[model samples]
Target: MLSQLQKKLLNDFQQDFPLSPAPYADIAKTLGVSEQEVLSALQELKQLDFISRIGPVFPPNSLGNSMLVAMSVPEEQLQTVAEIINQFQEVNHNYHRENRFNLWFVLIGNNQNHLHAVISEIESETGFPAMRLPMIANYFINLGFELDWND
Candidate 1:
């Protein structure tokens, strides 16, 4: 569970990032703490694996292209197949989903053709057909939810 202070820090950071040379120092000033303390707290959070990364989250279509892919990998070879898929720099996120498809991943590429090529490569390498689901339309929803630390 995160302390109130940590939660407040995350909330503030999410809403606003300091637009200055020393961003951390600016954050410390806004949060009423020393710069060193802010840095230490961030490092501690990262060490605890609560925070995977602290940076910009880009718009998916801002780049050339992005697609969601699902593969029906055999249970025995799931790990090996996942590793192979993850090797591509174009592959951003991958997960084991509970479905007949089993393995799901996101691939972002320089263009639609490049994205298709990556999918083909994965299929050839893993010997599993990848089902590509390119986003034709999107409905943005405010999908924010608070975690109940006391639970």
Candidate 2:
């Protein structure tokens, strides 16, 4: 069960989380709790699987160059390929989808050259040529949820 503090955190802090060096301390001050309390509660929430993670959701192409890559990976090798692809810092999300191309992922890098290099590395490492599907546009659904704690 989520405490009221956790509920407020889920609802209110989805976006606009502190960008300061001491971000947790900033959150604590705003939430009227000690920094440690905020940290502990967040840790507990993670432990309980209430939240997958707490971090910034960068806008596409805003922070750096990125691409949506698809690969025709054999089903038996999907797990291995995903592990290798995920080893790169550039790869953030890798998913298995049903299609001729089973494996898909997103890679981000400091620049366009770096992004292409990462893709090349992934293709070399997997021995499967990947199709580059760079984003021409982005669409997002606001994901914040409000917990009705009164009930």
Candidate 3:
């Protein structure tokens, strides 16, 4: 169960997140709370797994190179392989799929070379070949939606 302030933080600030120098402070001002309260709530939200991450979302290949990479890992090794891949700072997110390419993640790098290097490092560390699936098309989907607090 989440408190009202936690619910508000999750629902209200999904989009138009404060972009000022002290964004959390700005949010606290709007929410009638201290900046420490806002930061503590956010930390709790993350610890509870209500949010995976909070940051900017750049278009594919807009600021840097990015590619969707997949790996076929044995079921028993899935967790270990996923953790190994997550060690890379370039990896944005990784998830499991019910298919041969069960492990999939997006890697963003400064350039093509950096992208491939990270991929190679991941393969070497995990001992699994990565299938690079470059984005051929772009789609626009608003990631933010109103959270039903009542539920």
Candidate 4:
């Protein structure tokens, strides 16, 4: 069951999250709760699988260099390769797709050179060549949506 505080937290702050040093504290102030309460609720939400992550979404190519990489890993080695790829902090997230390029992920770095070096390292470590699909056009996708607590 979800508490009213948790419902409000989920419904209220999808966009325009605080960017200050004490973001949670700022949220607490806005919600009229203690900072610790907000943090504990978020942790509980994660443990209950209500939320996967809490972070900012930046515009493409606005912060730093990034690339979309795909790999065709053998079905038997899919999980293992995904684990190895996750070991890199540069990797944002990876998912398995139904296409021939079964595994895809986004890698971010300080510059193009850094991005290439990380890609090289990933290719070497996984023993599979990565197909780099650089961004040719920018598209805005709004990731935030209202959660239906009634569901």
The model with the greater TM-score, 3 or 4, is 4
Q: List, residue by residue over 1-151, the lDDT tens digit for candidate 2.
A: 7877888777788877888999999988989999998888899989999888988776678888888999998899999999999999889899999999999898888888888988998889989999999987778766666656776
What TM-score fits each model?
0.82, 0.69, 0.64, 0.69
Q: After superposition, how far is residue 103 of candidate 3 from its true place, in Å?
A: 1.7
- CA RMSD (A), model 4: 3.8
Identify the leading candidate in terms of TM-score: 1
Candidate 4 per-residue lDDT, tens place, 18-132, comes to 8899999999999999999999999999899888778877787889888999999999999999999999999998999999999999998888889899999999999999999
| Model 4 accuracy (lDDT, Cα) | 0.91
Candidate 1, residue 37: Cα displacement in angstroms equals 2.1
lDDT of 1: 0.84
Which residue runs does candidate 3 get wrong by more than 4 Å?
19-57, 76-89, 120-128, 141-143
Sequence-dependent TM-score of model 2:
0.69
Query: Candidate 3: how large is its RMSD?
Result: 4.0
- On lDDT, the stronger of 1 and 3 is 3
Cand. 3 TM to true fold: 0.64
How displaced is residue 142 in candidate 1, in Å? 6.2
- Put down candidate 1 lDDT per residue, 1-151, tens digits, no spaces: 6766577666557645677899999888888988998888888788888777787766668756999999988899999999999999999999999889999999988899999998998999989999999998778643344554556
